[model samples]
Target: EQKAVLVTGCSSGIGLRLAVLLAQDAKKRYHVTATMRDLRKKDKLEQAAGDALNKTLSIQRLDVCSDESVAECLNNMKDRRVDVLVNNAGVGQIGPIESLSMQDMQKVFETNFFGAVRMIKAVLPDMKKRKSGHIVTMSSVMGLQGIVFNDVYAASKFAMEGFCESLAVQLLKFNVNVSLIEPGPVNTEFEMKLMEEVGKSQFPGADAETVRYFKEVYLPASHEIFTTLGQSPDTVAKATMQVIGMRLPRLRYQTNALYTPLVALKYADESGSLSVRTFYNLLFNFGPLFHLSMNLIKCITCNCFRRGAVSPS
Candidate 1:
């Protein structure tokens, strides 16, 4: 019996790739419902899905922020059966918190945090009743380790981390699995757009020095980080597929191997000085090595957080 997999935000990026990859599964183990907020934006996904369209894969309209839309989409599914729910729909907030609007920040949380919760709530009962299901969410490296100028976006993901971590425990009794896929600097159009906005944003409420630090110091480092460590959407999709294929998927799976040591900073010290100080130093210290920052980042993280040999798997 092919598993019924439903993925949201499938119009582009990792979501699009994941839906198409599952539909094209050689074993024919999945029937996929790919969804987006608007059908008008679906041409890209349709083109990508190719042979799988309307055969193993179907597209539908779903607004994760709207309860009614979530209900209607699931209701329309055959047997209302979804064996795996991939909550990949999210919006990002950038710039300093002081410069960003209250409205924009709320919008980020609504879509990134509450929006995902809405989908989970919509599907959980059915999953619990069946005693077989997987809930996969798209998280970020920021969700595990905070980044400067990405405060609100990181907070929203942090909310997801906490919410799912707590919920996963209860869902275990019902045989439901909750998995978080944390990727660092994914090479997606979404990120490209964010970088463009960062370059052009006026950052009205922030002082000139703060804006300078943001645009001068952080932006270059960000570009270097992306150039060095970014994972393509297809790679991210493959990692997600691997998790789904696992007989017992882990609660947290990070897709970027390069980010593992950096993330380890959080656990390396009880006082939190190691992680914070290391990042603070890196933020200002590596201007000359900006083009080859992978070396700099690796050196710092490895020195601070390396404890044991990482498994090849």
Candidate 2:
């Protein structure tokens, strides 16, 4: 039986491209199951595979947020064993903490954290039976270090990182590999969708001043970073295929320009002196520098009492 890989969120961006690229690999050693929340949106994914592709990619329906949907999708694939599973379905949100609600945080977790867990639960039985598998969680650079206005989204990635870490230890006995893709910012509808979701998740009960601040200071600054720094999904897609194929894949993969420097800083922080780089990282991440001003603005405007706001999924 040919080995198969299962990837979620294949309707667009990285998930879609990864499926297509893996399907077109010259060796054509693996079968690919490209799953999305809806089959109707698969035309572009189909196009990406191209008419002359040597590999096979079958589209399937998988809404990670729904247990029934996940179970149903898994049941349908009973005959086909999955060797690699990529949990790539995620949403992003940004806003003033006061204007964001608990519901917003829960919703983000529902899709990004809990949803991934649900999918794993659905597939683990089969993998356990075979004593082998590879699980890929699409995390972000934000997963390692906090940044401005990406509270909800970053938290979700952070949650996944921790989960994947513990899962790696537990699955070692079974030779089930767990890896995280911590790409910086990939150019995709993800950014735009984050903006839109944050806007919609605003609290109606928030004071007028709070609302005004979110409109003026918070969202724009947050959106600007994503708009400018993100890379093409194709870059990550190709890298991801390589990640799955490796016999001894690293626990985490960072595919961005600043990753090397950031990794260096990780050692710096661990060593001794709070160097300029460490200081700047602290200032930007949690200290009273850029985000401090934004938070102050939000506190005054949105009546926000917290530093981080959550977004609805």
Predicted structure with the largest lDDT when compared to the true one: 1
Candidate 1 structure, TM-score to reference: 0.94
Residue-level lDDT tens digits of model 1 in 194-226: 877776778888999888888888888887788
lDDT, residue 227, candidate 1: 76
Error of 1 at 260 (Å): 0.6
Distance (Å) between predicted and true CA of 121, model 2? 1.3
lDDT tens string, model 2, 1-313?
4568889999999999898887877777678888999889988888888852434788889999998887777777747578999999988877666667889878989999999999888888888889999999898887876555567877888999999999999898898999998786678998777666765675666787766656765555554434544568988887788888789877888765433343345555764344445534534454335455434433453443221211111
Q: List the residue pairs that clash in candidate 2.
A: 209-301, 210-301, 210-302
TM-scores for all candidates: the values are 0.94, 0.80
Clashing pairs in 1: none
Query: Local distance difference test, per candidate?
Result: 0.87, 0.75
